[model samples]
Structures are given as C-alpha cells and as structure tokens.
Target: MKAINPKTKTNWEAIGVKPHIEIPQTNALDVAYKMALNEVKKSVSDEHQIKDINDKLEELSNSLPLKEK
Candidate 1:
C-alpha cells in the first residue's frame, strides 16, 4: 500500500501565487510618519520589504506640494 502526499505535486508552477502583482498604496501624516516607519522596520525580519519602504521615503522627500514662482 503506497500513499502519496497531496502537497507534493508533480506540477507546482500552477499552485503558487499569481504573477504580476500590484502593490498597495500607503498614507502618512507627514515626514514623522516616514521616520517612524523606518524605525519600526529595523525589527522586521524581511529585508526586501524594508528596502521598498526606504525607496518610498526617498520618493516622498523628492515630491513637493507647494510650488515657487
């Protein structure tokens, strides 16, 4: 009597998450929020996500709401 594991599929490509995913939008009160996010990221386990967050901060810093004539 031989038993097969359902998790061990012959074709795994079709079981994983979908490709071409879209990221969610985030809102912050001000630069303080970005700073807080950075601080919190130090404790997280993921590094790639942290880098994405840091890049987001850079974008926010570059954007300006007020314009000069």
Candidate 2:
C-alpha cells in the first residue's frame, strides 16, 4: 500500500513503499478543541463587526436632522 499525497490527492510514493510521509492523526478531543476555538474566534470577529456597524449607524442617526411631530 502507498500513502497518498493530501494536496494533489495522488500517490507520490511508489508501490509497496514503506515508511512514506506520515500523516499525523488527531484524536476526537483535539478535533473538538480546535473546532471550539475556531467558533470562539468567529464569534469574537462577528461581535467586533456588529459593534462597528452599530457605531456607524449611531453616527449617521446623530448627523441627521429631526423634525418635531
């Protein structure tokens, strides 16, 4: 059996090859931690974007003239 290259999705090693490029496998806990970290990063990014949009909207509202009813 030959190990397949991840990038090109082809077998770079010759047939009956041993000790090819080793691909590190992650455990379930490691995968879950990475996924949670990504979600947290995305959430923080979304919060900052929302805050910026709100600030811009408030500035625009303040600049506009209001009329008495």
Candidate 3:
C-alpha cells in the first residue's frame, strides 16, 4: 500500500494522457451513501410495523375463547 501526497500527485494533463471522458461534478459516493441510509431507515420502519402487527395478533389470540374438542 502506498500513500498519495497532494504535492507528489501525478499530473495526467502534463503527461499527455488526456482522456476524452467527461466526469460529472456530482459525487456518486455521496449519492450512494444517502440511498443506502434511506434503505436502512425503511428497513427499520418495516421491522417496527411487523413487530406491532405481531403484538396485536397475539393480543387478539389471547382474547379469544378456547374451544374444547
């Protein structure tokens, strides 16, 4: 592993290695992070909802009268 220093960074333009590719100013990593965060939040919310539904079902089952065979 090598550490990259800003002062010793290679200049792609000076080396005549100009790539025709155009990069967007937007940070893709930040976008991905935000998307992942949102998914985690949604998953947590879904878990809570499922737990609440299960708790309600248990209560309902307990309130029902048992039938003898």
Count clashing pairs, candidate 2. Answer: 0
Q: Candidate 1 lDDT (Cα, whole model)?
A: 0.58
Instruction: State the lDDT of candidate 2 residue by residue for 1-69, as single tens digits.
Output: 756779867885555435432323433344344445545555565777657655654554454343113
Model 1 residue 41 lDDT score: 80
Flag clash pairs in model 3: none
TM-score of each: 0.41, 0.30, 0.30
Superposition-based RMSD of candidate 1 using all C-alpha atoms, in angstroms: 12.8
Q: Top model by TM-score, which number?
A: 1
In the order shown, what is each candidate's alpha-carbon RMSD?
A: 12.8, 18.6, 19.3
Q: Model 2 off-target regions past 4 Å?
A: 1-45, 67-69
lDDT of each residue in 1-69, candidate 3, tens digit only: 444447867454445544343233354344344445545555565777657655654554454343113
The TM-score of predicted model 1 comes to 0.41
Give model 2 RMSD, 1 decimal.
Answer: 18.6
- Which whole-number lDDT from 0 to 100 does residue 40 have in model 1? 80
lDDT by residue for model 1 (1-69), tens: 334447864443546544342223332254455666778888867889888878886776666342223
Off by over 4 Å in 3: 1-45, 66-69
